[model samples]
Target: MTLPTPMPDTPHTSAAPFASPSAAHAPTTLRAWVCHDYGGAEVLELQTRPGPTPGPRDVLVRVLAASVSSADVRIRTQNLPRGFGLLGRLAFGLARPRQPVLGTDVAGVVEAVGRDVQGFQPGDAVLGVAGVAMGCHAEYCVLPATKPLVHKPARLSFVEAASLPFGGLAALHFLNKAQVRAGERVLVIGASGAVGSAMVQLARHRGALVTGVCSAGNVALVLALGAHDVVDYTAQDFTQTAQRWDVIADTVGASSFATCLASLNEHGRYLSVAGSLMELLARPRGTRRSIGGPAPERVQDLQMLVDLARAGALQPVVDRTYPFTDLPAAHAYVETGRKRGAVVVVAWPEP
Candidate 1:
């Protein structure tokens, strides 16, 4: 696949350079999961495709690990807005995924760098957004140096690093939007899920006392992730409790706006990482009216997450790892909505 022309190099900022990996023989052809229709994970098929050529400022990464998220599932099922449908089909290919690949959050070693690229060479260990472009569920995925790509933390393995980006970014964004502070009480709904689990830790790292809502099975897990308290959603509704929270981070969108609002302290923020098609479509109108609501803030949040990871204040809670060939099963497991943490897809053959 051919990438867009690279962007001009800007003055080197204070940001740290990506860590270069050990060089290895590069492959010309790569295996990837491709999809022709909008449906379940079954629609995804394995195929060989021409490896992507990096434009100036781009790095071609040999994917060692990737992850499946709810966003990928939505795209696969055609459950997003009309624009997503139209643009996804047009940009990806109508009637099927234009990129055909599914996994997004990626962690890998760089295979080659574009001519104009700086800070990254032929071999670099990195993690970043896959955007809506090249599918990361393959042997290689390309990302611009200017994108959210950052050096992988030395403490994390490729699979662990791959699981962090999307959920970490989303959780960080919502927590910041909430402006949680020390001693403040924060409630995280769906706290055992990928993004929810991240919120549990990030909020705690910010010094806020966090209460996580999840099933009984995951209460212990949420607590282990740094939540000060855990509310079992199956046994009781958190909103009915006497405790008033300064912030409510709803990752599942499982509760109504009214319920969330009812639980919040005065002038408290209610942030939702997951939203319906109607909510996304109505977002612009809400913004135009100066009414604050859930918004999908991406790139900037991703950068913040990288900082936290580098600082050792945040870490991914990866619940399961699947071989690349079992991507279908991974997708199916994610759809169950019971996953305790991020589901990782490891591209490298398991030793």
Candidate 2:
């Protein structure tokens, strides 16, 4: 679908004013989904909390929609590997969450922009990732203007735009690392899932022959997303297949390093969004290998995904959307590992 061209200079008056007395008197509060002490979906509770204020280089977005990701699930459960666990504990709070909000991807209207910000102004429709300080699950979030924030594609609804940042950037960054070329074969495991589905589309867009691996139910969906082939994981072993790919994107991390390596051709790249405990343990040793490299985490790569979405070359695959009050249910769905694409949390009432 083609997106409407964005008029960046056009002023939008539909957004609620952030400077209103109602907002100021209650500046210390807003409704948000908070994870007081992380565990399962049960940990997420809707509560009133202090709203975030934009810094000099930040934009305070009135979030319309936000998404639940596997990364959020990992952090919520404290299931990350040793280093990540320590980092999370320090960065986020040692006992409870420093940033209790659990969302990363967001699509929203700019309610306010910091004094030094220039590129975006109040009322701009935008989508991007909000890293460690994840307050997107609330009514508002403050993100650095210099981060990946970009104009939202007019073709996508807020719910759809909310699904892109994390998975899209991960796919784009991994593909760039893989250096995929036209006619090269690309295999995306967990293709029906968020990151996997994104990788499939992106690899195809790069003119690579893309094969998507998913359950039988999602084969058509994967194929519709531009995959050249779809492998039903329930019916067969993709790693043992005769095909050798130039790049293998293992989104779920269900496949081991050995299995990924085995499926690759010479000088082929193996990429994954979710890292296993084993991979983290072996990182030091594998860092020097040609087959294994450091994981992708470039902010510029996120901008590239934003551009792709705006250009209509990328589209977020949303599995389901829950109201702001249903955050626990959304978290539960993410934990199940059966969601076809992204699980979005709509933060505000629709127009």
Candidate 3:
């Protein structure tokens, strides 16, 4: 349960000479799960393609593990949150996903770094988030060195490290926006999920009295994550309670400003990680504010999460892992909306 502390210096795992940016022009063939037309789990196909080449400022990673998240499901099925259907189509693709490969979180080895890149080199174990520019489902992923890429701690395996970025980054973004103060009451809906679980832990880390709302089966899990209280939504509606929180975060698209307005304190913030367009456009009734839309991708925020993970302040919650070949199965499980945390796909098992 405890990951080892990372050294201040970046860890090196291989000593081979890395290809220069110019040498990367001729890419080798690699296997990848590609989604040409989005419809169902069957849309993902494992196919052979030329490996991605790094640009002048890019870093090419040989993925060891990747996570299948709710975003992947949305991109796959076009089942977006309540009002963003047309917007999603425009951003993704009218016919299908603009990006054929769908993955966000990845833990891998730095196969090569661009000529102008620093702080990373060939053979460094690393974890990164590609965000909306999804491509981690492939054997090789190319990202800018300035993204959320960082050295993987020595103690955590590929699967464990792969679970951190997607959820942690989102939670950190919204929590920072909410400006949760110490000793304030914080309520996290969908607390058993990826973003929600990270929200609970990160809020607690910031010294808030965190309360988690989840199903009956996840009460113990949420409590173990350092929540001060747990509300089982299966048995009770959290909004119906007399209690009001300083910050209420809905991570599963379950609660809206109209529904949670009365439950919020005078100056409380309602964070909607999966909010619809109308909810995002809704005006504040009073002092209570609703914050929504996608969280911005920041390397600094990702670095903060890596530091917290190294200090044992953040713990990754991986509900299950599947072989790289079973990625379609992972997508199916995530679509069910029952996963406790990240669903990881191990491309290269740890030795």
Candidate 4:
């Protein structure tokens, strides 16, 4: 839902008293990273401001931890991939980001629920993605009960649970659309990334012969995630090799349908998780087909990811963790494009 009022364009300097994270009663205001402009990490300012109120169908959560993803970086810097510039501006904002608190994946304890909410109550540990609502990068966030919110399993901590939704959800959506089958030859490009890592594990668990293409530094990490083979993209190009795959999934914008067409086997499926505009608009040429678009944010998918994590089938690779106050540092680190897996922020530690 669009907020009724846009946050102030000026910095907030009021030192008025506000409830701490440990407070029992609901807080009228909460601390959050607010970005009023489209720029680098420097644009993000930590300020104490009014928090969002839960509507009749909404649930308010005390955010324990949240993951800083590529999506967050893109929105913050307005540095989307080529061909997505206009789309990004239109969807986000022409002058600035539509959502100032830029985070999608969240893990925390429920603090309050609207009257119409069900199956969740105050004090329940929960984890889910806010998706385009994107307010998880704060001490508290509101999620609609009908969204992807679900109970957090005891096996995963706040950070680990925070790592699952963004990557795992996208991986699950693409894999399902591709209809991956047991014993099929599957190749995941950029296998060290959030989505790639999740796809590696999920594909392996589906009994596919999974091959991961990544830099040499992430080869062992991909192997540990159950990929049968690792193609060091630094050493050689997997597409130029003689190997053919039934499914070729590009988690990063490394390869497109045209580039990987000849490398695909008969009836192969190509998944473009971060597709360029041309790639998204391109049609299937031959026996192989391509799939690309926004990944659906489904509660069922989030639940499946949680279940897989509980069963040890999905392992969330968190490369680094940052204190909530150091979220700008986290954003700077992610901007380097070197971090593997998720970059998590401790939103507010458990009391």
Candidate 5:
């Protein structure tokens, strides 16, 4: 459960790029998971590719762990919100992925850095989301020096750190936007899921009265994550409960947005992850609003999670870890909609 601490000694940063890996470990090419076409996990094929070289402002990370998030699944299956399909195709690819790799969140060691890079070194241990330029499913990937990358918390493993960025950043963004504060009643649907789990912990840390809605099987998991109360959706409908909340976060879009909005107290916040076509039509135009958008990726936001982890307030839950070669299987597992927190794919060095 605990991860080794990175050496606190200030790194020797420079405008000049770090040199290539020593001859002992140097290799001209590497293996990576490439998504040639998008439909399902079967489309992700293992292929050989030229190794990546850091740009003038990039750091090449030797990925140790990469997590398959809801974003990855949606993008792969074209399960996007209405009117976003064309945008997705244009940004990603018409038939296959533009970058070909699927992972966005990763925890790894910096293998090299570019001339203009600073605040990191060739061997710094770090974690972050790669955003739109995602390619973390490979053994190596590049991250902008100014992106969400941050030092891995001392007590978090590569797998744990890898799991935090996408979910943590999302929950933090929506919860903060909702003006979460002390003593407010907060309810998180899909509370045992990636974003949902993070919301539960963050709301609790912010001194809110936290209630989580999950299946009966995951009731204990949500409660163990600091949710003050847990609702088993399989046994009862959370929206039908008599209690009202100051904030209702539908981390997963499965719940009816309108029904949730009606359940909030006057002037309460409704934070939906995205605009489901049905939700778009029912959106409020007044004080009782429904806000949904992409979760922003920023280094400062990712660092906040590290600070919380150090303070013992945030801990990323890892549901399962698969070998890098088993990414397709991992994807299949995630598609089943049964994972507790996150499903991670760990890299194995090539022979």
Candidate 6:
């Protein structure tokens, strides 16, 4: 896990504004927003709790930022796609939250590491997916060092870093499932949303001719984000388009499997993050498959995201930023399903 590194007297220079909670009246136990039961955002309650310490292969991170994604919403609402209720309850909780604090996307600094850990030291800025352990919405959280943890790229702010893990990983997974290749034709439905937006950029980065489907208002925005062509779903139906795609990735399940099938060229891939029953039934159609059952969590993929961001090929889309304490409003806004991209929560306020 954590490679051996010397502890620094100061946090990374850029992270100075995101001062650790331990700086002021540092308490042994940290304040955490906890979820005891599954319900709406109202189920969340802010309470002081004992701080988490690193395990032998884990690192304790002072959370600087976290993201409110569809997974978090699903966990809170107990709505785990169709037919996944039992499995979801098993992984999450039967009647209550298995992980109490439901946030997976994390951008933070190493506060401490376990005895067996290396490659990290106090004040090292880092970012990664916390997975189902879901303890990111707090002043401090412990993360497995073996996962996709990496040093935060110098180019992105904490909010931007927070935005990448969930959406970026999902998009990367589905895109790879589609096997996007150079000179291929890629179409991304729900292009204005988080995963779809990342899919557009990654497909383009792979040298595909990218087309994006979104609302009329987001047409220019999608185009600016590197979509070769923009389809306004409000005014037109993409299923009726003349052009065919080599890979059809639907992030919001806005298009049916039949529509995606008819729109795809022979042997093309149809990927969906949110799949309908019809799409699930269409899985045997040879080219159709539903993605996002599990997210992509490979460290190499995380490194690719960092490299793309550093090279200015991929940019994290942050629709809005909410203070860590305003999670209720953040959840309420995400429920509206109108966010342009990712919504971020700043766990640690800027000093």
Best by TM-score: 3
lDDT, residue 309, candidate 5: 79
Ranking of predictions according to TM-score: 3, 4, 5, 6, 2, 1
Task: Give RMSD to native, each candidate.
Answer: 8.3, 5.2, 4.3, 7.5, 5.1, 6.2
Candidate 6 to truth, TM = 0.89
List, residue by residue over 1-351, the lDDT tens digit for candidate 2. Answer: 212221111122234444532212224557888888978888888777766665777777778888888778877887764346777688677887777787877888887777777777676778877766577788887788656687776766777777887678777767877688999998888998888888888999999999999999989889988998888999999877778887777788777556666677776766755655455444312322123233454556766776787787887777777777778888888888888778887745432
What Cα-based lDDT does every candidate model obtain?
A: 0.71, 0.73, 0.84, 0.84, 0.80, 0.78
Residues 229-266, candidate 3, lDDT per residue (tens digit)? 99999899988889999999999989898999999999
* Candidate 1 minimal-lDDT segment of 10 residues: 1-10
Q: What C-alpha lDDT, on a 0 to 100 scale, does residue 140 get in candidate 5?
A: 81
lDDT digits (tens) for residues 157-232 of candidate 1:
6766777876787787677666679988988888988888888889999899999999888887888889998888
In model 2, state the lDDT of residue 236: 94
Q: Write one digit per residue (lDDT tens) for candidate 5, span 65-86.
A: 8998778887788778776788
Models 1 onward score TM values of 0.83, 0.86, 0.93, 0.92, 0.90, 0.89
Candidate 3 — which residues are off by over 4 angstroms?
A: 1-27, 348-351
> On a 0 to 100 scale, what is the lDDT of residue 78 in model 3?
93
- List candidate 4 segments past 4 Å from native: 1-25, 347-351
How far out, in Å, is residue 328 in model 4? 0.5
Total clashes in model 1, counting residue pairs 3 or more apart in sequence or in different chains: 4
- lDDT, candidate 4, equals 0.84
Scored against the true structure, residue 193 in model 5 reaches a CA lDDT of 88
The clash numbers for all candidates, in the given order, read 4, 0, 0, 0, 1, 5
Q: Model 3 residue 200 lDDT?
A: 92
